[model samples]
Target: MIERLLGTPYERRLLGGGRFSGPTAWLIAIMMFVMLSVAAAGLALAGSARLVSEGVARRHMAQITDGRSTGAAAVAALRAAPGVVSVTPVPEAELRRTLERWLGPSARDPDAALPIPVLIDVELAPGAAVQPVAAALKRAVPQAELISNSGRLGPMLRAVNSLAWLSAAIVALVALATASAVVLATRSALAAHRATIEVMHGIGATDEQITRLFQRKIAVDALAGGLAGALAAGIALLLISAGSLASAGEWTGGRLLGTLDLTLLALLPFIGAALATVVARRTILHSLRASL
Candidate 1:
């Protein structure tokens, strides 16, 4: 059905690609670009949120200032715990380095250099309660404090999830704008060519033939716009991925956030094109029915 509609030449000469499309293609392209960007953001946000929400991804720090079973003993005890997954004690020097990397020039002062916490990172199995890990750490080292600082992370995840929702809403608005443009253009074309269409009908042309003719141009215009938008978005995402990767340079195991694959945004063009085509066809069919 689609092939036949696209193949129709009479509609091509009638709509001629130039009469109706003009700057309308540019409008769709711009709308598609913004839509696809939002779509990419929404997809990445959802994936990151799911990763952070996982129970197995939970991490805690055993900040030991002074403890009996400190360092190796604490790591071994935590390793043997039922719910615990892994225990790696961070070296003081490495901790200072990480702080310096984040703090920059402020961390260079010898007198102002603060004492880094003796941090032992604890990983838990999926769905495991933090209570068991904390209990095991306290039992092993009386002075080892369980620093489950997921308190601040909860708000961040909520914020990402909210941003995802906002992105999705923006995509919806863009889609509406594209559809509206197609509908309005189709109507204007129909109004301009009404007499020619009626004359064709008087000869023998069915309403379907006339409708399909106009639809071919609408589909072509939509596809052109969609392609432009898709290419722009694909280039932008590729550039961004080259700059930042999710697994690279992560300090916290629990708070893994950068982006999931934004390649899904590439499909937005086809989606937008299909949406525009459908809206145009429906509007044309309705207009034909009303004219009769």
Candidate 2:
């Protein structure tokens, strides 16, 4: 089926001409860039969300273990505290490394070190009152500062949620822009080849055949554009992530980094391609019918 499609005169012309057409090529290039931008933004947003969520959790856990001297004691107290499900103390060395990674080498030096606070990890009961627990921990631990993970986390989560929505909106806008570009480009291509289309129709070419020719041509163009965009976006995202990792030393002291799922990254290209193809096909079909 692929061989036959490729063998067709329309397909051959489209493959050759579409590649050479400066405007059409540019449109594809722009689409690719936009797709990549959206992907990068989405990844960043995800990273931020994870960082904020983890930070909040750690802070809250610290609140639970506030003022406790021994790790064992902190854990035990946290366990006994109302709304606490479990508690674990993060090692001081590990915490130092985490801080170093985020603050950089200069920030990690001895002179730069502040009296580091101890961090305790806590899990809350399913329906626990977070505020009450935080207040209780504040009272129980005089030297130990109580950090309500939710209090710190709520704003970050909201920001991330907003960013996610914004990314979605941007993606939708890009899709619409790509579709419009394809429609206009296809219309122009059809117009330029009007004589050819007329001759084909006059000689008994059916609408289906005409549609298929245009569809096949546009689909290939869209695919190229989508793949290019996805690749560009992926590369840009990697660069951003690398830079971020260097600066932040793994978000949320590495917990957030752990949550950066590869599966989500892998799904991006397929989604871009599918969306591009559908939009291209629809735009071409609609434009062609209107022209006819």
RMSD per model, one decimal: 4.8, 7.1
> Which regions of candidate 1 fall more than 4 Å away from where they truly are?
1-5, 18-21, 52-56, 64-73, 90-118, 125-129, 142-144, 246-264
TM-scores, each model vs. reference: 0.76, 0.66
lDDT of 1 by residue, 162-240 (tens): 9999989988988887888888888988988888888888999887878778776777777887788778977886688
For candidate 1, the TM-score is 0.76
Q: What is the C-alpha local distance difference test score of each model?
A: 0.74, 0.64
* Model 2 per-residue lDDT at 286: 72
| Cα lDDT over the full model 1 | 0.74
Show model 2 residue runs off by greater than 4 Å.
1-11, 14-22, 61-147, 246-249, 253-276, 279-292
Q: Give lDDT tens digits, candidate 2, residues 52-88.
A: 6755564455632223254455555667778887677
Q: After superposition, how far is residue 200 of candidate 1 from its true place, in Å?
A: 1.8
